[model samples]
Target: MQSNQANDQWFQSAAARDIHLDQLKRVERFNGRAAMLGIVIGIITEGLTGAGIAHQIGLGALVDGYAACRTQFLPFCF
Candidate 1:
């Protein structure tokens, strides 16, 4: 009877551990999605208002393209 009780206790603890892990994974997913949404909003606001989120996306590519054009073709670069 004592061995049966011990088995029951072990099963309970194992089940609790699995539940805790599942909850942790859910929380992490929620936090990641929330953070991504916030960043997207910030980027859109910046794009619409000329705010300092200028460093957010493909601005670097634009700049590099412009520079290459100026050096290779445009005479007005000076």
Candidate 2:
């Protein structure tokens, strides 16, 4: 927006100023809550299944039975 070239002070100032600790705390708090909820859902699902959830889904379970052999095939390689 300047007529001539200028330094990037505006963007730098926007990045550096720290007026919002409470907002940051709220963001972190919500993130933690979401993660905890996910864990609880995972635990409940595990309880529903007779066998416990493995660290990783077993190879046999992931590929053929997973989304008709198309979707989860690539993720299993990782």
Candidate 3:
């Protein structure tokens, strides 16, 4: 009887682990799809607006800041 109980516990733990791994796989797939969708949208927006993705998102200031920082030899500039 104790041996049967041990086997049952081991089976349950294995099943639970399988379920968790399946869930992780599903989440990873969803994240990958979402990232691809974001990239496609960015590309479409850039094409429509005739602006690069960085410019559309207002990263120009950030780029300029980095250039300024490089010239000034600053440790940190944003």
Q: What lDDT score belongs to each candidate, Candidate 1 first?
A: 0.80, 0.63, 0.90
What is the C-alpha local distance difference test score of candidate 2?
Answer: 0.63
Candidate 1 global Cα RMSD: 6.8
Ranking by TM-score: 3, 1, 2
The lowest-lDDT stretch of 10 consecutive residues in candidate 3 is 55-64
TM-score of each: 0.63, 0.42, 0.73
| Candidate 3 structure lDDT | 0.90
Best by TM-score: 3
User: Model 2 misses residue 28 by how many Å?
Assistant: 0.4
Candidate 2 lDDT, tens digit per residue, 22-53? 67888999999999997887678778874444
Clash tally, candidates in order: 0, 0, 0
Q: Which should have the higher lDDT, number 1 or number 2? A: 1
TM-score: model 2 vs. ground truth: 0.42
List ranges where model 1 is wrong by over 4 Å.
53-78
| Candidate 1 residue-wise lDDT, 1-78, digit = tens | 999999999999999999999999999999999999988997788878775453455475666567878788655543
**What's model 1's TM-score?**
0.63
Residue range 1-78, candidate 3, lDDT tens digits: 999999999999999999999999999999999999989999999899888777778997777678889898677876
The list of candidate 3 runs beyond 4 A from truth reads 67-78
In model 3, residue pairs whose N, Cα or C atoms come closer than 3 Å (at least 3 residues apart or on different chains), thus clashing, are none
